[model samples]
Target: MLSNRQLLVLQVIIDEFIHTAQPIGSRAISKKDEVSFSSATIRNEMADLEEMGFIEKTHSSSGRVPSEKGYRFYVDHLLSPFRLSNTDVDIISDAFAKGMIEFEQVVQKSAKVLSDLTNYTSIILGPEVFDTKLKQLQIISLSNQTAVAILVTNTGHVEHRSFSVPANIQSSDLEKLVNILNDRLVGVPIVQLHEKLSDELTHLLHKYTSDFDAAYHYLKGALFDQQSVQLYVGGKTNILMQPEFKDVEKIRSLYSIIEQEEEMAELLRSNKDGMNIMIGHENKIDAMQDCSLITATYSLGDQQMGTIALLGPTRMEYSRVISLVNMLSKQLTNTFHSWY
Candidate 1:
């Protein structure tokens, strides 16, 4: 166990290293004046810290940097709950108030804004399709043989897919079909109720033998689109600016993984509810070995929600990001209430 003074020294060193992104020396802590410890004492404590894997000496410079273990310990033990100012709240609130903002747009803007504020590459994960609520689902016939399935969320965002139908079906019949589906499924989470629809389908729409197959296929497609959470990443260019990612090979591999929509969609799909934090090596993806994700669920109730996650380097300021993500999700639920 580290002594009280030693622990305090570790905290100070980590804070100083985070700000400067450089190895700190005993003389530096000694010169702080505020630290109150003599250079010899601080140096001894730092040496003990290094032996315990909390800090590392990189060269003959007599300076040290916080090891990954040190960062982990600091985050878990030393960090306190962060408090935001009215100004901070207002900044996030304005991002929510932008009119008719599609979920994708909101997510993209958030990443851009966060990266701009923090000077780090940022990521935001959109709502997962599994938790998407069935707010406004409409079937509009484009031709006798095709129709469009347009869906609107309580968030005023819309998404649609074109579905081909039997030519024998009438527009009136399609409208009736849509009404039946909407009446039985509206406000219900599509994914939760999706798999149980087998028994309910043939019996419910037995009237239209010519249309049953097309309807089932269309509805099935809608229900299983669980990978629908669109991710919006910004500041890929900015990641290139970070000294840690300066290695060209590291940058190439990292960018490749981030650019893969399938992998990102899979990440959001797994966050079923509530806030989740994944630190280094905690994530399943090998490519994400050096990154961390701070995520929260925005739910109307227990049944429906979307995930909002921030992706950044593993050395991210977790306290601030966690607070920001939590507050942003709360605002999302509050803003969506009026539409519901």
Candidate 2:
């Protein structure tokens, strides 16, 4: 555990390394970038910081650089909101605002902008189940024994499934139940749908009639299916050109993590409240120990949770990347809310 002063010194080293892609020395921290400290005092702080395993030296000729511990500490303690210049914000906003006909297209544009701006891979996620707000739901009777369930969310994502209903329910009764369900559930949370509907199930069936049992069971089954969950991934190939990941084996390892649905889902679900930066080894994934992940959350309407993230080597562009993502998240929130 280092003192607050020592931690600030380490954060400077890491931020400098990220910006210049060069090893940083004590003189750099002591000199004024944004802080006021003398060179000798900075050197003492650097030495103490190094002893605490936060920064390390590469060679006798080179300056001290941030260690994995240093990066983690810098992110958790010393970081603050990074402000973007007006020019940078305008360029990306104008580029993406041309025409986003579909919500998927908007997500895709975010990935491209992240890669183009920082030259790092970006991951933009759709609403998690907990973030999903039901905009509409209806059951369409295809026949006496089967019905098609259509569900829509405020984010414009749509899901449909064919359910095998109980043999006894008439088409007219199923049609009546559909109207009943829609009025009550139009703005409900997807997470609350099952229990909320279940609470009203007996009342719904009795009100619709005794013939509605089969349709009720089928509706429950449709809601529980995992197909209702959706994941969107783009810019997966953008990081391949970085010099830090030119090695074939390293590239393959990173690809494996991105390809796994569970890995991406776990990453999106994590740290919903604050901007999260997971450094080497601090993240449980062995394959990503050489990389850093910076993630932030965006809200959809009042009911959905969305995430924006950037993936780069341990030597990532911290100030600029943070600024870009923060602004982009607000843009996304504005765009999402304006739609409905």
Candidate 3:
């Protein structure tokens, strides 16, 4: 445990480093209005803090910087509740005021709002389709040989795919398949659609249609073939503005990890309920060792629907970003709940 003096000195050092991205010396801490100790006393405290692995001296400068251990301690013990500015609140309120109807629009707009507010890369894992029940299905004909199949989920998300209509399959046969699927499959969760279709509805389809095999094959391939998670990212280039990422190779490596949508989506899904912060080496991925990742979950009632995250250097504006993420997560939950 740290005494009052040590805690105050650590807080000032971290706060100064966050704003200036430069090493801080004892003299600077002594100059702060909140600090009443002399430079000599502050130096002794700094030395003790460094021995405890909270701060380290740079080879090029006599000043000290916070280590990953230091950042972890600061985040865990020193984070105070930060208030959001009126303008910040107004921006979030205005974004949701556009009367958007689709989940994609809401999530995409959220990504943009967060990135613009914090100047960091924002990623949102959209509502999991597997968790949502099927609301409706439609098959629209475009030509004699081709048509479009639309799947609507309970959460207001829509997905459509095109498939080939063979000469052997008559229009009446296609209509019959659609009717059978709608009757049997509505209100089924997307993840179980395939199993439900094959195990339970096969006999029903076989009873009503002459060639159930062919029509069922086409419908299954069209809708159930792809049900992966959705990921939305905004301001990917904003990381370039941070001085810590000035190394070209470092930026390239980080971008590669972000571009792997599946990996990133899985990583975000692993977070526990509510807010989580991982600093520097605390992150498991290689490229993110020098970065900080903050994540918060948005839910519908008791069920967690997705995650909202911000990625930036370890010197991030933690208080403000934490407030923004916490506020946005709650807002997303409320917005989604209102829709249902």
For model 3 the TM-score comes to 0.94
User: Per-candidate RMSD vs. true structure?
Assistant: 3.5, 4.9, 1.8
Worst 10 residues of 2 by lDDT: 224-233
User: Which of the two candidates, 1 or 3, achieves a greater lDDT against the reference?
Assistant: 3
Error of 2 at 291 (Å): 1.5
lDDT of 1: 0.72
Lowest lDDT sum, 10 consecutive residues, model 3, at: 297-306
lDDT of 1 by residue, 293-318 (tens): 77787765445566667766766777
Best by lDDT: 3
| Cα-based TM-score, every candidate | 0.81, 0.74, 0.94
Please, what is the whole-model Cα lDDT of each candidate in the order they appear? 0.72, 0.76, 0.90
lDDT of 2 at 326: 82
- Tens-digit lDDT track of model 2 for 61-81: 458888887777676677787
Model 3 lDDT per residue over 80-132, tens place? 99999999999999999999988889999999999999999999998687788
The best candidate by TM-score is 3
Candidate 1, 191: how far from true, in Å? 2.8
